[model samples]
Target: MSRTTVLPVTRRATIVGAAVVLAVVALSGCAGTSGSAPEARQSPSKSQSSQSSQSSSPSSAERTPAPTKTTDAAAAATDLTFEDGAALSASTLPAFGLEVSALDGWEQTGEDSSVGSREYTKSDGSVATITQQRITDLDPSMGDRAATEQLFTAAGMPAEQLEEQLLPTMTGGTAQFLSIAGHTTDGSWSATVARAFAKPGAALIVKVQTPSQETLRPDLHDILVHAQVVLT
Candidate 1:
């Protein structure tokens, strides 16, 4: 029998073993790469959670509202109205007692008349007011003249004296009278006549305002002539 070559068989077996080792190593490397893929996907989910938290919070400036301003119409709507022949007495008025009669061609327009002050509005848009108080009520140290001036100023008609005269009263007495020229709260030129009456520990003031001295002089004269003042 011919002898077989032992070296050739050995060489073939060695090559086959080397190929199997390389195949095993390649399969292990592929499995490791696939397991690490989930970690990369988890990084994107963490980033999305952080973004959602930042978007939900609001700043202080975005949550607050702006302030609004007041209008003239709103101020006018709050003014109170009065009826004709409304009266005020020492019990209701702060310092003096008086009764106001309804004047022809004028309408009473304010609630203050029921509590010691009277406001009137004429058809031509003229305004007048009669207010009375003790001299001490205006200022503890003020006299009748100074208090009268202060009253004019407080009523939005700061006085510039035009004349001083004697006003005839229904009780057959004379009251001190003053004619004044000034500007109203709306800056329009105004004329006013004021009368001061003496009482027991108090003084009564009757003031009428108009666009001109001639406009309400007759009304002023009539009001002063018939006004009754009780010494109490």
Candidate 2:
């Protein structure tokens, strides 16, 4: 008869326990891999955060807009008014029926001897003369530019540079101011002339003579600015 051989019970149990333990270890390794997969996916979030930070910052090419520039002529046009400036003394020119003023440091001279003209001299040797005449032949339809040219021509003065100025009068009128700058007829000295028309049929002429235009321009401008037209 053939007989079957059997192993010990403890030894069989030990082998089964080892198999179970190996299966648990394999499942633990799989769980660890699954948890680490979420961590790996988080790397994209960090990369996106870095990109977002870079986009929020200002670029190197960005700049603020610059301010506009204000010119002297433009400033004079807007800032100069009838009320504000240096103190002045008023004198009426009876020939033109208009009033004129001289600023401080200017003394009136050549009173009646000039015949419808008044002369003013400053301590610095700057000279200003004011004259008036009935210009019956002056055509008002030709505009101030033409009148200025005609006046300069008649006075034998060259109008190298002609600029229009706006002078406000106390009588609520705006006189047309034509400013001319050039050397005299003989080219001996630089001079500036301002022709102002406060009324029709007459013209008020102011001539300023100096060694150079630079030295005379300020005084000429000031005199023109302070001129008051009082029609009596």
Candidate 3:
């Protein structure tokens, strides 16, 4: 005779036993919708491109005369898919004028412009979201990180759960990837790796909730090595 035991999964259990998924319901586009709709094609339709351009492209008054430091590149590329082992750096971060890359076996799961942030999944089901926010109310007196914490508060990250870390200035000519982990005021758990640029008033943020920091380190390392940002 053989006997087996199964334990129920609890919230705390998930922090270590399973991959983490922290859905940001209050923040629009933080967690994009996932329907039975077929996966997005590598090549977006021309109409879709035109529509996206019309909607997101800034007007003459809004357009920057020149790209800022963190700006990835002037032109956008196609089929720039991010996979587990590969690295990417392109004009992909239009909002924050930056670029981001992560190592590990992760595949993007969903992205809806109206919803904002893109989502990704790991082999173990760990999930992460990438999004950007441009800010203008920065106070240099507070310094880069303190100013960033203020922005974090406004974006809905609670104070208690915040764990801030300093990012390096470069990675063989790439901007450094830094992170913060925290829970929302409402108690939802999340962690985001962010890079802030003061010159142009924008911050590129990537928040992921995994079983633990250990689990996401590899990907974060990849991001740090390849991430690029030019705030001004």
Q: How many steric clashes between backbone atoms does each model show? A: 1, 0, 9
lDDT of 2 by residue, 90-186 (tens): 1212122223332567777765332345677777777776665545564545544456556665555444434444444333333334444555543
TM-score of each: 0.41, 0.48, 0.43
For model 1, how does the per-residue alpha-carbon lDDT over 128-231 read when each residue is reduced to its tens digit?
65555333343333343554455555554434532443333222222333445433454333444443221112334555555653554454543443333322
Question: Highest TM-score, which number?
Answer: 2
Q: Considering lDDT, where higher is better, how would the candidates rank from best to worst?
A: 2, 3, 1
Alpha-carbon lDDT of model 1:
0.34
Give me the runs in candidate 1 sitting further than 4 Å from their true place: 1-102, 113-115, 135-162, 185-189, 194-201, 211-216
Model 3 weakest lDDT span, ten residues long: 8-17
Rank list by TM-score: 2, 3, 1
For model 3, the superposed segments whose C-alpha errors exceed 4 Å read 1-104, 114-116, 136-143, 155-178, 182-189, 211-214, 230-232
Which portions of model 2 show Cα errors greater than 4 Å? 1-102, 112-115, 139-145, 157-160, 185-190, 196-199
What C-alpha lDDT do the candidate models reach, one value each?
A: 0.34, 0.38, 0.38
Error of 3 at 84 (Å): 33
